[model samples]
Target chain A: MSTVNLIYFSWVRERIGKGEETLELPADVVTIGDLLAHLKTLGAEYESALEHQNVIRAAINQEHVDHGDPIAGAREIALFPPMTGG
Target chain B: MTAPITVRVQRDDFDLAAEVAALTCGRADIGAIVSFSGLCRDEAGALNALELEHYPGMADAEISRICHEAVERFGLQAATAIHRFGRIEPGKNIVLVVTASPHRQAAFDGANFIMDFLKTAAPFWKKEHRADGSAGEWVSAKDADDAARDRWTLES
Candidate 1:
């Protein structure tokens, strides 16, 4: 098991009610998809924020990665809705 | 000589003329300078201010990376981008991108490139504050912005 720091932003943060958290990743949670699935089981807030998983974007160690990307050795991960910046 | 690249994500407003002058002043080689400033709009008089949020570290890194790419691809003499966060009233400046090159074409293209990429790639979000003292919903990502960014991919 590895401890990973998860950060949320924007509406995702609003839904989850927190900006960041630290959690222990089970061995089965080896990819971003798996992590998101595990997060969905945590509580209603996580499930609500991650309901539309396909629309959410993830960054592992500050670099954007696909959901299938492996999370091995990742220290930090962030998830948020698609960017609306200009 | 390679031009300097400046990327800043701050809460404070920036001075456009001063930024451009700092990049081009004393450099006779710069033949043209182009700039783009994004302003906060009232959204048809429905909003009092626009609140912007961003992922601090990633915002700076991503914007800097794209600015460098724009500078290299366009053969720019210099490029600078400044994005503001926090509550910005309607009519205030939201972002500034300035590009300088020996020719007008590169300067123009570089500035355009920076703006296009910044629209989609940067980790920033905007929420409207309605004029009636109600908090508006978070602004959703626009397909138009994604389309604008897509054009650059084909050209590159």
Candidate 2:
């Protein structure tokens, strides 16, 4: 079991009711996709924030990564909705 | 022989003319400079301001990466992008992109490329603040923005 820091932004943060947290990932949580699925089982807030995992994007260590990307040795991970800047 | 590239994410507003002058001043090699400034629009007089949020470390890195790509792809001498976070009043500048090149077309296209990618790739989000003392919802990603960015990929 390894701990990973999770950061949420924008609506994802609002739905989760917190901006950041640290959680111990189960051994099975080896990839970003695995982490997302595992997170959905945590609670109502996790489920609500991650209900549309398809639209939500993830960044590992501040760099954007696909869901299939490995989570090994990652210190920081952020989840948020699509960007709307310009 | 590329000039310096600057990328900044701040809560403070930027001075357009000053920023442009800084890039072109004392540089005879730069013959053309194009700049684009994105302002906060009221949109039907209902919006008072736009509140921008960003992933601090990621915003800088992503914008810098895109600006670098624009400079290389467009053969630009220099490129700069500034994005403002926090509440920006209507008509105030929210983002700025400036590109300097030896020719007019490169300068123009470089600025456009930076703006297109910044719209969809940067880790920034905007929420409208309505004039009626009500907070508006966050703006969703537009398909048009993705299409705009995708066009570049197809072109390459």
lDDT of each: 0.92, 0.93
Model 2 lDDT tens row, B1-156: 757999999999899999999888788898898999999998989998898999999999999999999988988999989999999999899999999998899999899999999998899999988899876899989999999889989998
Q: Which stretches of candidate 2 lie over 4 Å from their true place?
A: none
lDDT of 2 by residue, A1-78 (tens): 999999999999999899999999999898999998999998999899999989989999999999999999899999
Q: Model 1 residue B112 lDDT?
A: 91
Measured over all alpha carbons after superposition, the RMSD of each candidate to the real structure, in angstroms, is: 0.9, 0.9
Write one digit per residue (lDDT tens) for candidate 1, span B1-156: 767999999999999999998988788889999999999988789899888999989999999999999988989999999999999998899999999998999999899989988988899999888998876999999999889889989877
Candidate 2 pairs with clashing backbones: none
Q: Please give, for residues A1-86, the per-residue lDDT of candidate 1 as tens digits.
A: 99999999999999999999999989999899999999999999999999999998999888889999999989999999999877
Error of 1 at B56 (Å): 1.0
Error of 1 at A15 (Å): 0.4
The DockQ-derived docking category for candidate 2 is: high
